[model samples]
Target: MGTTGVRTDRLGLLLAQFDQARETAQVRLTGLSDAEYLWEPVDGCWSIRPREEAVTPRAYGPGAWVIDKGAPEIPASEYAEVARQAAGGMSVAKIAEDWSVSVERVEEVLAHTGEPEPDVVPVTTIAWRLGHLHSGFAGQWEWSFGERRREPRLMVDFAPSADLALERFWAELDRWRESLGAVTEEQLDTVGFSQYPYGSDPDDPFISVLFGANLELIHHMAEIAVLRDLWRARFQLPAH
Candidate 1:
């Protein structure tokens, strides 16, 4: 109908989507054990780990626990094989078959050819997914609604255990929901309303940023649900 009405409708839709996704995730996460939270379905999955056990070049958070991010250290031996595979023109599928690994693993290895940084998406544990959601919400809230000075990577304290992680995750989600609830109709249409520096929030309308955030929550939470399902069914599957 009117500009105000449109903005209100858009905001309502985004909030409903976010709430639905969050509720679904929470339902899936119910009674999640520490073993399931930290379970890595395959080798080389990026995940949360004790500080001393971290293998990634950079780890986030200040607590005893850290989320794995940045370039992983590929062994020199693996690099040598990568070189040989490239030189021989081996198909990714063939390479994976020969190595007894997933095709995604072969692609990830190949992605490290020119750059040392992580360009490939690795499999992640539930802890890692939850950590990402927590940091994203915290960071956006700070830059968009708070002081806009502190980076969440340095400020967020990673939970040391599954129970603590779920607690903090819900808290961050509440903070983000509160911030969203305070936005006015005009603010939704205002470009640069969200000054989140890490993303395009400063250049796009606040509504766009909110939509993107909803998408992030929906997709990542769906992944967490699938991981839970896999964890439950792992014992029933025949050995490969």
Candidate 2:
């Protein structure tokens, strides 16, 4: 086949894969309720909360977003270990004073001290996942292809509700698709065509960047799907 024909075929194949991933992501996000979108089945589950209520443990860490609440003085993960060390000897007042939480909450924590620590991968709300995808596409497009301007975006800018989030997500996908379609054979084959500074793109070919973006979208979409399933089944699990 001719060079033009090969380029067309390659781009076509990539586009098809991208569209399939996009459709799967859309399907995963369909019909989510607000509560479900923000569900936190376990403490420290990263979900969209009001600025005042944002409780993700990493929020307080260095490089956390300005809007994200700082981590509690005593992280939720450490609570179990701390309680175990106390071994039913630590008073609620002492625990609360040390952790900087309400005494009532401390008592509750003490009661559940014997339970295993939550093994979560920093659960994020559906809204957060959707917003993250949208921003990721937008940022990569802007940094790698469009104008090369590093404009920062916040998750809240995507959408406040599931319906709006889906709408915005598809719109960003469409923009990404357009950018993908515009890549010529020369651009794709050229090393360092994508200069996305935050990633390895500066040292990679445009095609590699495209493939990486697909993997990211697909993996994150699957993660969101799993989170939704867990959210739906949150009430069905028997207490340990």
Candidate 3:
């Protein structure tokens, strides 16, 4: 096969996978009620919440609702370990290895300077998972096809309800599909075809970015589906 044929095949496979995942997600989302969408089955599950109720250091959205996102503060006990490690002359790398965390995490802990770890993936609700998928698509679309100037957090408005969120989510999915549809054979092979700032999109071939995006959709949608199942079974009697 020629180069053009290979590109067409690759792009075709990506679009097909995306479409399938979208369809599956839509099916899972059918008749999703606001209660189910916002249900927090476990303690500290991240989900859409009123702006005033948001616990994250930074929440995304301009509306009454916001997504619980952003780096969580380290706990006081965890920070005490950092202090202990530091006083013991442990290198940042050694501390990170001992904690099974990244060196950057160790640095952040050290730089935190004894601040208490704030009470904080937190099993996310359907709403939070959907918001994440929406952000991924919308962010990629904005950077790759739109003005390419604004960050996605600034570009998206968090939906306040299940219906509205689904509406906006579908719209972003369409935009993403349209953008992918326009990629040329040469563009797929070109590095930095997608200038999305959040990930390594700008450093990799467009095809690699496409595959990653598809993977995100597939996995997140499956999670949403499983959440829906758990929600439905929450009130059911267990089998003996």
Candidate 4:
């Protein structure tokens, strides 16, 4: 079946619906507790449960702290380290490549670390946060296109508290939506978009990748929400 046969009007409407799902996904975890964050709906299954210590996507947002000894969460220092690297024109791709991380990974760090506070900051504090973001999205996007690749050998590993991960994920989607505002419809049909590493195909139109992204985005959002609900119930927390 020819892909171009899809109606543009329908596509827009579909995207809008996907947008709603995305919004709902983000809002689903507005109020949750630490215990609830770890609550599992079923036995032996893990949810995207956000923990204070849980690392979500490749990012570290506000309130992240690292003050332990033998420790990395030294915010001022890490900030300076990242800042110096950035000011020295350290691009995400370069960072990823240098650290044996994928380009998508670098992007995740940039998204989560947020300019490294313009100076050195704690390396340990947001380490998990940064790793999760990079790994999850990179893995997910790869899965979306059935073009999965070798795993990224990142510099660190971090998992967030389920709630925090959900929150950060929601925020990341918001970031995507904001960024999409700058994407043109013409661009949607344009060829060879590099934004999606494994998802975008050179032979396919932009709309095709857009369609795939639409589905992937909504699906992940729903998966996350369900994970939240399941986690809450595992702890006997009220779903309402």
Question: Among these predicted structures, which one has the highest TM-score?
Answer: 3
| Model 4 weakest 10-residue run by lDDT | 65-74
Query: Would you list the C-alpha lDDT of every candidate in the order shown?
Result: 0.81, 0.67, 0.81, 0.46
TM-score of each: 0.75, 0.65, 0.77, 0.44
Ranking by TM-score: 3, 1, 2, 4
Model 4, 1-240: lDDT tens digits are 138764357445656765777667546656655555444444433233233443323333223431122222223334344445556676755554444556764555555643444553222222233234434444433433324453422211333454555555555555555555555677667766423443224435656766665766565555556655555455475568
Better of 2 and 3 by TM-score: 3
**Tens-place lDDT digits, model 2, residues 125-155:** 6666665666678777787667876653432
Q: Candidate 3, which segments miss by more than 4 Å at Cα? A: 1-8, 72-120
For candidate 2, what's the RMSD? 13.1
Off by over 4 Å in 2: 1-8, 52-121, 154-158, 237-240
- Give the alpha carbon lDDT tens digit for every residue of 1-240 in model 3: 356664347888889888888998888799999899999999988888889999887788767888997664345566875777688676777666566568887788787754564554378889898898888888888877788887787666776579998998998898889878889889999988788876557756888889999999999888888999999899999899
Candidate 1 residue-wise lDDT, 184-222, digit = tens: 889999988877765457756889899989998988888
Q: Clashing residue pairs, candidate 1?
A: none
Kindly report which residue stretches of model 1 are placed more than 4 angstroms away from their true locations once superposed: 1-8, 72-120
TM-score of 1: 0.75
